[model samples]
Each structure stands twice: as C-alpha cells, then as structure tokens.
Target: MRTFEYRLRPTKAQEQALMRTLLASRKMYNACLEDLITHYKETGKYLHLYEQDKHHGKEAHPDLPAVLVDTTLKRLHRSFTNFFRGLKEGRKIGFPRFKGATAWNTIQFRDAANCLDNGRFKAPLQCGGRMRVIVHRPLEGTFKFARIVLRPSGWYLQCVCETPPHPLLKKENAVGLDMGIRYLVADSNGHIIDNPKHARKTAKRLAHAQRNLARCKKGSHRRKKAKKKVARLHEHIANQRKDTLHKASRSYVDGYQTIAVEDLQVSNMVRNHCLAFVIADASWGMFRQYLEAKAESAGRQVIAVRPHYTSQTCSQCGESVEKSLSVRTHVCPFCGYIADRDENAARNILQRGLQVLARTGPSSSRREGPEQSGESPSVLKREAAGL
Candidate 1:
C-alpha cells in the first residue's frame, strides 16, 4: 500500500459547511463522554453504544440536531472500541473528551465518499475552484481511501492506494550507523553526516514569534494572528527536519543493502532536559521508521544492535574504555587506536550487528529488537531481561 497527500481548497460556503460538520462532531463527542461518565457512576459500568442509542432514540430535544446526535453517537462508539483495545494491549485507557474552540479548527474527515474514486477511491481535494490533482509522482495501483487533515497552515488530503510489490535489488555489502548529537550519523565506512542544527538555527525566530503571541490578549484578533505566525514557524521547522531525514535515509538505503544501527531508546534519551531539543531535532526514531519502510520496499535488510557497549567498547580490541559526553575523541588504550568517538561507535555497532545477523539470519534483521519467531537471539535475550 502507498499513500499520497495533496493540498485542499474549498469555497467559503464549503468551508462553513465543513466547520458545521466538525462542530456537530465535537458536540456529539462531549455528550457521549458525559453520558458514559454518568452511566458508569450510576451502574458501575459504562453504557455501550447500543444502549446509548436506544436511550437517545426516544429523546426529543430542540437543541439537538439529528445529524449532530448521530455523528456524536458514532464517535462515541469508536472511542469505546479504542479504549477497550488499548486496555487489552496493556496501554493506558483513553476516554473521549470535549474539543476546545481551537481544537475544532483542526477537524477533518476520513474516507469520505466524494474523495474516493469509483467506490475504489476518493478524489484528492485541490485548491482553487476546480477539483484538480497535480500528480506529484506516478502511482502504480488502485486508490482505496482518502483522508482530509487540517493543518495549521492549510488543509491536506492523503490517499491510500494498493499496488503490487516490485522487485528491489539486494546488495551483498552492509553498513552500520551510529547516531549522535555532534554528528547526525556516523557510518562504519568512516563517513559522517554532520548535524545541521536546523532547529537551533531557527530557534530564535520561533522564540520571538511565541513571545509575541504570549503578549497578545486571548480571543483577540492580534492573538489569532500571532498564533498563526508561531504555527507557521513551527511548521517550517518540522518540514526542514522531515526533508533532512528523508534525504539522509534515502542515501543510506540506496547505497547499501544491509543497514545496521544502534537500538537507542529515544524516549529515555529525551528525559534529559539538556538534550531534549537536540534529540527532537535529530528525529532519530522517525529516521529509523523511514529506513525500515524504504528498506522493506527495496528488499534491503536493517539490523539494530544493542546500544549498551557500542560507545565504550573498542571495535578492534574488544576492550571497554571510559568516556564522557565531552570527549569527542575515542582513544583506545589497548590498541592505541584513535578516532572520532561516533565513528568508533559506528564501527563497533557494525561488527556487533553483523555478528547478530550471522547468528539469527535475515528474517530477524529488524533493529527494533527481534522477531517473535522464538528463534532470534535478541528476542531470547529480551525475554530473559523480561522485556
């Protein structure tokens, strides 16, 4: 399956209709949540959608529009299903909540009939008067569904389509990558992609915009304008970061068949206040996601090795040396080898990743840890660790 996104344009009247639909949805969402809470309080269990529907079906109210009520009830049902699923998966239960005034501004529809082509797919919403689609890239298969999304700057529609998988070449050579704050990534082949600090460069502008926004009175026209300016700045930063990740990951996928990387827990890394901005700017997790998707499409392999000793252990000597964040150079006492810390770490990661691949085989190549096939060494290790 492939997805394509296009910008959307709607007339003033159409935009008003869309807003009304979203308002109805939001009102319904809040009503359902209140109903659930009331039911749970009285009966010790939440009311199901069928029960709620039956109760509301008998009610006659001047304030409630039929369309709004129906939309709200359906949304309530989805919320309940999602809540139950999350509980089953040992995730925190999510309860539906009311949308604030600003929240309703970002409402969108998914899988609308008009957006789909022939019962097969929905058309892309275009800007201007005519329904136009600029083919940014050629697609291979039948389109299935299109989703409308409201962004801070404008609206966008994404179409999901199905296409036959094409054959992609698999090279024999492999490379390992080490991600760091100083350098974005260091490869086993002694190549380093320097950290651009794109976010940091734009931080002052973002800060200024935010400060200006904060000074504006709430609900005032000035506040709204300031808020939009801030949003635009954030959107710009996000786009730049996304572009950088795409370019960097695409280069790696195209150059090597086997890609190895350290399985760093990004959530934990972000806990450090000093490193949070840098970590967010790096977008290591997103980079890994892109690598996986591209690698899968290209029939390439991605291996993730435990990050535990990659930085401390010498790639050539297998000896551990103490190092600090301030230490940019890796000086191995055992072998007297000197190199950039990230470069040394990348080489170590490559060696360890290759060792894992040799032991577990290609099917267990994911860097996210191990396959659940009950045979991968990393999986077994994770099981032993109670992961």
Candidate 2:
C-alpha cells in the first residue's frame, strides 16, 4: 500500500473546529480508559465496546458531544485490540493513557472515511464553510484510512491505502554503507560523503526566533505569532535536512541494486548528552526509513548489517585496531595500509553488505563485486543495470 500526506490549510474558524475535534477525541480516549479500568476492577473482566457503548450511550455527559463519545469508545476498542496483540508478542504495555497539557498538544485522531476519496474530508464548522484540502500525492489500494495529526507547525492528514506487493527488480550489484556523524556515509569502495550540517548552519536564525518566542506572554496574540515564527524556522531546517537525504539516498539506490546499511541504535546514541544534538541533527533513522521506502518502490533490496566492531576491525587485514573518536586517520600497523578513518569504515560496510548478498544468491542477473579498472564486460553490465 502507498501512503500520501497532505498539508492542510484550514480557515480560522475551521482551525478552531479542528482543535475542538482533537480535544474532544482526547477527552473521549481518557474517559474510555477510566471506564475500562473501573470495569476491570469491579467485575474482574474487561468490558467490550458493545457493553461500554450501552452504558456510555445511555448516560449523558454534558461536557462531551454524542459524536465524540461514540468516536472515543470505538478508539478504546481499537486500542484494546492493539494492546492485547502487543502483550501476546512480548511487547511493552500499549494501553491508552490520559494525556496531560504537554501531551494533549500532540494528540490526534486516526479514523476511516476521513480520506479524500470519501468526500467527507471537508467538514462544515463555525469558522468556515467546508474544510479545504490540498492532495499532495495520489492514493493506491482498497482500504483507505486517514490520520489527523498535530505537528509543531500545524495539522496535517496522512491518507493510507493498501495495494499489491511490488515486484522485485532483476539486478545484481550491491553496495554497503557506513553512516557516521563526521562523514555522512562511507561505502565499500572507499568513497566518503561529507556531512552537510544543515541544522548547525541555521542555528543562529533558530536561536533568534526562539528568543523572540520566549519573551512573548503565554496565550497572548503576540506569543502565538512568535511561536509560529519559531516553528517556521524549525520547518525550514527540517526541509533542508530532508532534501539532502533524498538526494543522497536516490543517488545510492539508483547506483546499486542491493543497499546495505548498519542498523544503528539511535535512541541509545541520543542518551549521551554530549552527542544528542549531533545525533538528532544527523537524522540517520529518518534517512534509513527513506531509503527503505524508496528501495521498495524501485524493486531494490535494502539490507541492514549488525554494527558490532565494524569500525574497529580493519577491512584489509581482519585485525582489531582500537581508536578513539578523535582519530581522523586509520593506520593499520598489521597491513601497512593508510586511509581516512571514514573511508575505511565505508569500505568495511560495503564488504559486509556484499557478503550478505552473496549468501542469498543472485536475485538479479547482475553480479556483486568490485568495479574492475579495465573490465569491459563488467562495465557494460553495470551500465545496463543502472549501477
């Protein structure tokens, strides 16, 4: 299934209505959670939606609208189903909990029939006529779903549709990548791509906007305007980062049939206070996600290798060399080889990826190997395969 996301431009009144809808949804979710807990405590059994609906539908809570009450109950049912599924799979608790003020701001609604195809997307409210939506991408598949999300900038709709599985491409060449903060990516062929540092470049503008936002009074008109200005700055930074990632990922995918990258623990990396900003700004997680989706569409294979000792082990000599983060150059005493630290790491990543592909056999007719300096047949195959 292909998913499409659209930027929504709601009028003032429509925006208020949307906010109210979100608030109502949040309230309903919390109330349902409370009811479930109460029922479980009293009867030693969980109450199903039909049973909860009978009780809630009969009692009138003056604060909540009838529509909101119904929606919330259904949401609770879905949440319960998900919670049980997660539990069965040894996942952490997935119950819907009460959202506080800070959390409430992030609350959103995911429901069916809210998609563009249903024509029910434009809802009438006090602030405006029908809500207008701009479709960013076309949807594909049978079942359609929509998510009303709250972002730092504003609200958006993500429409998702399920479709047939994509066909695999018939290509053989593969490349492995080692991503790092200093160098954006290193490949098996000793190629190193420099980090753009998009966030660092815009830090000054972001700081200025943030200072303005901090000085404004809470809930005041000036404060809201200042907050939006800061948010816009953030959006710009994010866009710049995403643009760089798209270009890099596209180039890699277009050049190789199979792409291998290390499965990094970004959350663990962020735990280090000193490296948190750099890690977050690098956005390796988001880059990998983009690569996966793009590769899927292009019928290429994306492999993730275990990251253990990838940097410390010498690719040529197969010997361990301890080096601190401060080391910029890799000098392997065992092999008498010298290279830039990042370039060496990238070559190791490429070798690991090729090893994995070799085990799977050639899914595509193209062979995964090093580019020969003067091999005409190999060069022709690489060109025909778009590598």
Candidate 3:
C-alpha cells in the first residue's frame, strides 16, 4: 500500500466542525485512558480494549462518530501495546498518556469506499462535508482508508491505496550510500549530495517567533497567534527537509537497481548532544525510509549492512585503519591507496551489502556451488576471526 496526500480547503463552518470533532475525539481518548488507569489501580490488572468497551460501551459521544470512536480507542490500545513491546525489547518508552486538545489532530475513517468523486474529496463528509481538494496526480488502485490531518499550514487528507508494483528497467545496477551531516549522501559512484540544513536556515525566524510567543501573556489572543506562527515556521522547515529527502531518495531509486546503506541506530546516534541537532536536521532516517518505500514500489532492493567499520576500514585493501571523526580523507598504509573518507565508506558499504546478498538473497549470483568455487566464504570468515 502507498499513501497520497492532498491539500484540503474547508469553509469556516466546516473548519469549526472539524475542530469540534477533533476536540470530541480528544475528550473520548482522555476519558478512556482515565478509566483504564482507574481500573488498573483498583484491580491491579490491566484492562484491554474489549474489557474497557464492555465497561463503557453504552456511552454516546454525539460529536464523535462510531467509526471515529473505534479508531480512537484502537489507537489508544495500540499505544499500550507498543509500550509493552518496547519494554520487552528494552527500549525507552513511556506508558500511554492522555491527549491534549492541540496534540490530537488526526481522525481516520475506516469505511473508505468512493472517497473521491470527480477528483474532489468525499470521505467523512459529516465533519467537513465534501471539501475542495487538489488531486494533482491521478490516483491508481483500490482505496483503503482516509486520514484527515490538521497541520499549522492547513488541513490535508491522506489516502491509503492498494497498488501493484510498477517495476522500472534497471541500469547502474548497484550502489552504496554513506549518509552524513555534511553531505546528505555520498554514493559508491562518487556522487555527493550536500545536506540542506532547512532548520538551520530558518533558525533565526523560529527563534524570533518563539521569543514573541514567550513574551505574550498566557491564554491571551496574542499568545495564541504567536504560537500558531511558531508552529507554521516549524512546519515550513519540516516540509523543506522532507522535500529534499524525497527527491534524493527518488533519484537513487530511479538510478540504481540495488541500493546499499548503513543500518544506523539513529536513536543511539542522537545521544551525542553536540551533533544531535545537526543530525536531526540531516534526517538520515527519513532518507532511508523514503528509499525503501520507493524501492518497494519500483521492484528494487535495499540492503542495510552493519555500520561498524565502514569508515575505519580501507575500501581498497580490506585492512583496518582507525582514524578520528575529524579525518576527511582515507590513506591506507598497507595498499598505498588514498580516497575521500565518505567515498571509501560508500565502497565498503556496497561490498558488504553484496556479500550479504550472496549469502541470503536469491537475486544475487555471487554465491557459487562448492564444486565451482575454490573456497567458501565461511572459511575466509573463520580465518579472519582466527577461529
């Protein structure tokens, strides 16, 4: 399934209706959460969705439709489920919490049949009622569901649709990418894409807006206006960052049949306070996500290999050469080879990815039979490990 998002233009009355529905949904979410906590505290046992529904199944929220209520409750239940899963996986995750009025901004409609009529939005008409939508591109495939999202800029609709893969003919069959804050992407092909620091560019504007917001009296009209301005600035930066990532990922998918990249633990990487802000602005994670998603629809492959020593090991000599993060170039003593640090890393990533593909993926022909090969990869691995 793929998602397509479009701009929504709702009238003032419709906008009020949308706000009211969102508020109602938030209230319902909070009420359900309170009940769960109360029940758990009293019984010392947790209540799942069904049990909670049984307890308050008869309650009616006029503004919140039945479909909307189910979606909201399921979302709350899913949050708890995720929290438990995170605990089991030893991840840092907090328990489910109540949603504030501003926090809850999405309403999903489960029954999504004929969501569009003559290229106009039609789903969940009771709330916003057939609003004007820009269908910039033709949507292909069966409609699944519609998600209404309220952003600082305006309202938007996300349509999830089931579509078959549209494969493109491959050229430049494989390449690896080294992602970094300085350069967004450096490929094994020696191509480099500079990182566009959207947040940094707009930092001054954001700071000024935040200062204005802080000076405004709390709950005053000026405060609200200032807050919205800050939010819009933030949204603009996010959109700019997302746009760059999408274009870069799309180019990679279109140019390469197989894309290899480091399986970076971004959560761990962000712990370094000095580089955290820059790293977040770089958005390496979003780039990978876009690459994988686009590759899937295009019938291409994405290989994520371990990022342990790609930067330290020599791509030409296969020898370990440790260097500080400050080093911008790689010079191998053993092989007398020299190259850009990120390019060497990209080469190493591609080589490692090909090795992985040989071992596991059926698409690769790198693995030869025992009768045809001189030695197996396991023999070399064992020799390298001195085992």
Candidate 4:
C-alpha cells in the first residue's frame, strides 16, 4: 500500500469542527484509559475495545462521528498491546498517559467513502464542502482510508491506497554510501552530499519563539499564539529536512541499480551525550529507511554491510590502519593510499557489497563476508569516475 498526504484548505467553520473533533477524541481516549485501568484492577481481567466501544454513543459527544470513536478505541487497544509487548521483551515500558487537548493531532476515518469522492471531500456538522485540493499528482488505485491531521502549520489529509507496483527498471550501476553529520552522505564515487543541518540553521528563530512562549501567561491568548509560532518553526524545520531526504533518496534510486550502506545502530549511537543531538538531527536512520523504500519501488537493491572497521581498513590494499575519530583522512602507509575517511569507507563498503553479491548471487541482503572480487583498485577508480 502507498500513502499520499495533501495539505487541506478548510473554511473557518470547518477548522472549528476539526478542532472540536480532536478535543472530543482526546477526551474519549483518556476516559477509555481510565475505564480499562479500573476494570483490570477491580476484576483482575482485561477490558477489551469492544466493551469500551459499546458505551461510546451514550458517553461520547452525540454529534461526533462513529468512525472517529471506533478509530480512537482501536488506537487505545494498540497502545496497550504495545505496552505489554515491550514489557514481555524486557524493554522499559511506560504506562499510557492521558493526552492533553492540544496533544491529539489525528482522527482517521476507517471507511474511505465517508470523506472522499471525485473532487469533493466533506465532514460532519455541515462544516465541510467541496475542497480546493491541490492535486500535485494523480492518485492511483482504490482508496482504503483517510485521516485528518493537525500540524503546527495547518491541517492535512493523508490517504492510503492499494497500488500495483510498476515494472522494475533495467539498470546495472551500484554504489556504496557512508552517512555522517558533517556531510549528509558520501558515496563510493567520491561525491560528498553536504548536510543541510536544518535544525541548527533555524535554531535562533526557534529559540526566540520559545522564549516568547515562556514569557506569556499560561492559558492566555498571547500564550496560545506564541505556542503556535513555536510549532510553525518546528514544522518548517521538519519540512526542510524531509525535502532534502526525498531529493537525495530519489537520486540514489534513479542513478544506481544497487546501493550499500553501513548497518549502524543509530539508537545505540545516540547514547553518547556529546554527539547525541547532532546524530538525531542528522537523521541517518530516516535517510536509510527512505533509500530502502524507494529502492524497493524502483526494483533496485539496498544492502546493509557490517560497519566494523570500514573507516580504518584500507580500500586500496587489504590492510587495517588504526585511526582515531579525530582523523579526517585515511593515510594508509602500507599502500601510500590517501583519501577522505568517509570516501575510503564508502569504497570499502562498495567492495564488500560486491563480494556479498558475488557469493550470494545478487539476492543476498544479510551482512556476511564472502570471497573478495577479482576487480582491482584501478577498476574501482575507473568505475567511480564513470569511465
């Protein structure tokens, strides 16, 4: 299934209705949580969603759509399921907390027919009518479901549809990627994609807005306005980062038949206090996810190679050279090879990926060292140069 999201332009009345829907949904969720806790504690048994949903019409706002209530109950059930699943797996789990009025951002319609039709989208309470949807592209396949989400910027509609995959493209080029905070990505071809550092770039504006928010009196109109300003800045940063990622991933998928990247555990890496913020801002994991998803659609390969020693090992000669994080260049004394540290890692990643493909017959996605290829250093250089 593929999903599409479009910004929604709603009338002032429609906006009010959407806001009320969100508030009602949040209230119902908190009530359901309370009921579940009380039921379980009293009876020593689970209170399922069906039982909670049965009392919806009597307890919930009479005007609220049934779909909204059903979806909210389903969400509560899923949250509980995840909480138990995490506990069972020995992971730290927090009990679900009550959602604040402003915290609830999304309300989904389980049935597509309720909200969407040809050139028209309507909601309950006589608030909605024909909307001016900016159809950036044609939406394909059967619509499955639609959701109304409120962001710091504005409201949007996300629709999920079942789409048949296109025939795979015919391409033979492959490359390796090394992700870094300094540069967004370094490829095997010695090309460096600069990191935009969207959050860092917009830090001053965000800080100013946050400071204004702090100075405003709580529950005052000024504070609400200030809060929205802060949210807008955050939304801007997110949009900028997402745009950059989409462009970079599109290039990789369109240019290469196969792409290899280091299997870096970003979750573990973030534990280091010094670089935690930068690492999170870099969004290396998000980039890799986009790569894999796009590659799948383009009929390409995305391989994850073991990250160990990729930075220290010589790409020209099969020898290890120990270097600290401070070292920006790989100076291999054994073969007199000198290159940017990340570029060297990228080359090694490419060679290792090729070795994996040769051994596993181009279908392997697992991390395993197989026999090295017969290609020489000159051949790799030529390939990188597009010779």
Candidate 5:
C-alpha cells in the first residue's frame, strides 16, 4: 500500500471539533492502558480487547468517532505485545506510558471511502459540512484509511491507498552505491551527489531558539512559543533532507533496473564519538529505505552486499589491500589498479551483488550472512558463499 499526504483547511468550528477528537482519542488510549494493567495484575489473564472498548469507547466518549476509538485500542494492544516479546527475548523493555497533550497528536480513521473524495473531507462531526483539503497532486488507487496528524507547522492528513505498481520498461542497467560523509552517494557509474549537511547549516538558528526557550520561565506562554520555534527549525531541516533523498532515490529507480548497495552497520559505525555527528547527518538508513520501497514499486531489484573489505579490496582483480580512512585514493599494490576510494568500493559492491545474484537470483532480502556465528556479517558471507 502507498500513502499520500494532504493539508487540511478546517473552519474555526471544524478545527475545534478536530481538537476534541484528538483529545478524546488520547484519553481513550490512556484508559485502555490502565485497564490492561489492572486486568493483568488482578487475574494474570489477558482481557478481551474489543470487549473493553464498550466501556471506554463511544459509549463513554461519544464525541470521538468509533473508527478512531478502535484504532487507539489496537495501538495499545500492539505496544503491550511488543513489551511482552522484549521481556521474553531478554531485551531491554519499557512499559508503555500515558501520553501528554503534546505527545498525543494523531487520530486515525478507517472505512473512510468517503473521508477523502474530490479534495474534501466529509466532516466527522454531527454538524455536517465538507472540510477543504489541498490535494496538491491527485491521489491514486482505492482509498483505504487516513490519519490526521498535528505537527509544529499545521495539521496534515495522511491517506493510505492500495496503489498499483507502475513498472518501467525492462532494462539491463545496474549500479552500485557507496555511501560516504563527503558525498552522499558515489556510484559505480562514476557519479556523485554531495551531502548538503542540512542540520549543520541551520545550527546557529536552532541554538539561538533553544537558548531563548531555556531562559523563559517554566510553563509560561513565552516558553511554549520558543519551544515551537525550535521545533519548526528542526522540521525544516528534516523536510529538506527528505526532499533530497526522495529525488536521489527516484533518479536511481528510474534509470537502473538493478541497484547494489552495501549493507552498512550504521548503528555500530556511530559509536565513534568523532564521526557520530557527521554520520547521523548522512542518514544512510533513510536513503536505503527510500531505495528499497521505490525499487519494489518500480519492479526493480536492489541487492545489499556485505561491506567487509569493499574499500580495501581491489575491484579489478579482487586483491586484498589494506587502507586507512585517511587514504582517499585506492592504490592496489598487487593488481596496479587505481581509482578513487569510494568509487572502488562502489565497484566492489557491484561485483559482490552480481555474485549473489548468480548464486540465489534477485529475490534474496536477508543480510548476506548466517543467522548466528562467531564472525562479522561480511566475512561470514564471503566464507560461506565462496565469493
């Protein structure tokens, strides 16, 4: 399923109704949590999820839509499931906490075939009228469900639809992408996109707004306004980064039939204090997410090869050559191969991806390694796959 977002323009009364809906949903969620704890502790048994909805749902808070109440209960159920799973697996777990006014800012609606039609939302309130919606681009496929989210800027409606695939013509083009700090992407095709460093560019303004927020008295109007200002600045940076990544991922999906990229261990990489700031700014994980989603829709393939010695091995003859981060140029002492460091890595990634395809075709999505072993993700794959 694909999702489309639109801006909602509600009249004063309609806006008030929406706010009430949001508040009721939040309260309903918290009430469900309280009941879950009480029921679990009292009888050590799981309560019927929908049965409790009769007490805390529309019967108790009639202002909220029934669909909204149902969705809220499901959210609580999912959280409890995850919490229990974490405990079973011996992982860190935190019990779901009650959300405050600011934290609870979304209300979801289902069975809304009429909720978004002809660029208008049929008002959910008893007062019947249509709410203006800015449909910047026409939505595709059948409307499934929608969620109205409150942000620092304004209210937004996220509409999920069952979109059909729009596949491109078959082609044989393939490229490998090496993610880096200096450049956001370096491809096997010898192309590069520079990292814009969105957060670093707006650092001064963010710091100033944060300072103002800290100086204001607690729970004062000025402090709230300052907090919003800081939030807007952050939102701006995020929007910029998202836009760039979308464009880059779209360009690749349109041009290449197959895309290869290293399965980077970003969580492990960020442990170094010196490079943490820049690495977070790169947002490699976000880029990969966009790549995979777009690729799936476009009927293209994306292969994630292990990233062990891609930068150290010679792409030409597969000779292992040790190198440090300071070395920007890769000089292969064995094969006399010479290329830019990231470019060589990209080439190596492409080679590994092809080998994987030869072994298992283009349908493998698991990380290129065994489930558990005393080996790194890369070396294990290489030794097992004989690559």
Candidate 6:
C-alpha cells in the first residue's frame, strides 16, 4: 500500500465542516480513553475495542460522518494495540492519553466506496460539500481509504491505495551506509552526504517566532497568530529534512543492488545526553525506513548488520583498533591501514552484510547479532575480553 497526499481546496463551508468533524473525533477519542481508564480502574481489566464500540451504540455523531467516527474509534484501538505490543516486547512506552483539540488534527474515512468522485470528491457529512483536489500525480490501483490532515500551512487529503507489485530490477553493485551527526550518510565508496541541519539553519527564525508567541497574551488573537508562525517554521524544517532524506535514500536504492546499514536502536541511542540532539537531528531511523521501502519496491536487498565494533574494527585487517568519537580518521595498528573512520565502518558493514547474505541467502537475511549466528565461540570470547 502507498499513500498519495494532495493539497485540498475546500470552500468556506467545507472548511468549517472539516474542523467540526476533527473536533468531534477528538471528543470521541477522549471519551473512549476515559472509558478505558474507568473500566480498568474499577474492574482491573482493560476495555477492549469491541466492548467499547458496544457502549457507543448505533448513534451517529452530530457533525461527523459515521465513517469518520468508526475510523477514529478503530485508530484509538490501534494505539492500545501498539502500546501493549511494545510492553510485550520489553519496550518502554507510555499509555494512550486523551487527545485535546490541538492534538487531534486528522479525520479518516475507512471506505473509499462511499465517496463520490467527479472533478472533486464529495465526502459523507451533513455539511461536507464537494472539495477541489489538486492531484499532482495519477493514483494507481484501488483507493482503500482517505484521510484529511490539518497542517500549519493548510488542509491535505491523503489517499491510501493498494498498488500492484512489479518485478524487481537485477543489478551487480552493492553498497553500505554509515550514518553520522556531521554527515547524513557515508557510503562504502567514500561518498558522503552532508547534513543539511534544517532545524539549525532555521533556528533564528523559529526563535524569533517563539519569542513573539511568548510575549502575546494567552487566548488572544495575537497569540494565535504567533503560535501559527512558530508551527509553520517547524513544519518547514520537517519538510526540508524529509525532502533531503528522500533524495539521498533514493539515490542509494537506484544505484545499488544490495544495501547494508547498521541496525541502530535509535530509541535507546537518544538516551545519551551528549549526542541525543545530534542523533535526533540526523534522522537515521527515517532514512533507514525510506531505504527499506524503496529497496522493497525496486527488488533490491537491504542488509541490517550488527553495529557493534564496526567502527572500531579495521576493515582492511579485520583487527580491532580502538578509537574515540573525536578521531575522524581510522588507523589500524596491526596492518598500518588508514581511511576515514566512517568509510572504514561502511566497508566493514558491507563485508559483514555480504558474509551474512552468503550464509543465509538474501531472502532470509535479517538483522541479528554476530554472536548469535556468525563469529566462532573463540572469537566472541576474545572480543568480550578485548584480546
């Protein structure tokens, strides 16, 4: 499934209806969350989705469409599912919270069949009229659902569609990636993508907007305008980051047949006080996500190798060479080999990924610890003691 988003040109009445629908969905979400908390506290058991739906009955929301209401309830249920799944996987995750009006900005329609499409689409709501859509590109396959998202700039319509899979392209080139704070990505071939630092670059503008917002009185028109300015700056920064990542990842996927990258635990990595902000700004997680998605569609392979010792171990000699973060160049003590630290790490990652592919084949290859599947017992023991 793929999603295509377009800017919506809603009429004044349509805009009001959309806002009302979003507000109604937020209230419903809060109500369901409250029900769960009350039920859990009173009975010491969670209120499941179906049970909650029964309580809501067959009554339709005043201004919201039935499809929107149902979809919102289902989304709330999915949040619980994810929260519980995270707990089961020994991950620290917060429980679902009641959403305020500001928090809930999206309203979805589960069924695309109900929507009437001509030049514009008519949504199912009492006040919802036909809204003009800007289709920048043609949508493929069957439309599964639609979601209306309210952003700082304007409203957007996101259409989810099920697309047919095409045959994968065959290629001979394989590359590895090393993500860093200074550079966005360093490939095995020594190509480095400089980090754009979108947020840092726009820091002054954001700071000024924030200061303006702080000076304005709460609940005043000036405050609302100031808040919008701050939000728009943030949105711009996010868009810039996303666009840069997409281009970088797309280039790799298009050029390489096989791609190797570190299986970084970004959530855990962010706990380090010194590098947390830098790591978050790099957006390594999103880059990996984009790479994987592109690789999947292109019939390429992405190998997530163990990150441990990749930077410390010499790619030329396969010997451990201790280094600190400040050391940009890698110098191997055993073989007198030298290279950029990130480049060396990328080479090691590529070697490890190739070995993994040879052992398990590309189809079965996945993220795993070297000790669990590769590396002899003696090697593991030696590495444990830094022998």
Q: CA lDDT, every prediction?
A: 0.67, 0.66, 0.78, 0.75, 0.77, 0.78
TM-score per model over all chains: 0.78, 0.75, 0.86, 0.84, 0.86, 0.89
TM-score of 4: 0.84
Q: Where in model 1 is the C-alpha error above 4 Å? A: 46-98, 101-112, 116-135, 138-140, 197-199, 268-282, 364-387
Residue pairs clashing, model 6: none
Indicate which candidate wins on TM-score. 6
Residue 347 in model 3: lDDT: 98
Model 5 lDDT tens row, 226-337: 9999999877777777888899999998998888987865444323333324443346778888898888888888888777778888999998988766677999888898
Question: What order do candidates take by TM-score, descending?
Answer: 6, 3, 5, 4, 1, 2
**Greater-lDDT candidate between 1 and 5:** 5
Candidate 3 lDDT trough over 10 residues, lowest sum: 375-384
lDDT of 6 by residue, 17-58 (tens): 888877878988888888888899999998887877876654
Which pairs clash in model 4? Answer: none
Per-residue alpha-carbon lDDT of candidate 1 for residues 1-387, written as tens digits (9 for 90 to 100): 777776666557655555565565566677668878888999999787788887665253334445445545776688778888978975566666666756654333333344533222232232122343445555458766555556787766577777775537767888989876556788988898875677667767888998999999999999999999988887787787788788899999889878998775553432333433454434777888888878877778888777776777888898998786557789999999898887888899889878888887886247544432122223212222331
Residues 1-387 of candidate 2 have per-residue lDDT tens digits of 666667777777778777776676577678778888998999999898898788776255444445556666776688788889879975556577676544654322345534464333534232133555676556677645655566777776667777775655466677778776556677777777665666666767888888989999999999988988887787777777787788889888788888878766453342333322443435777888878877777778787666656667787887998786667688999998787776776667667777867687534222233331122212112222331
Error of 5 at 1 (Å): 1.6
lDDT of 4 by residue, 275-383 (tens): 3244343467788888887777667888877676788799999799888666789999999999999899899999988887887876524555533222222322222
State which candidate, 4 or 6, has the greater TM-score: 6
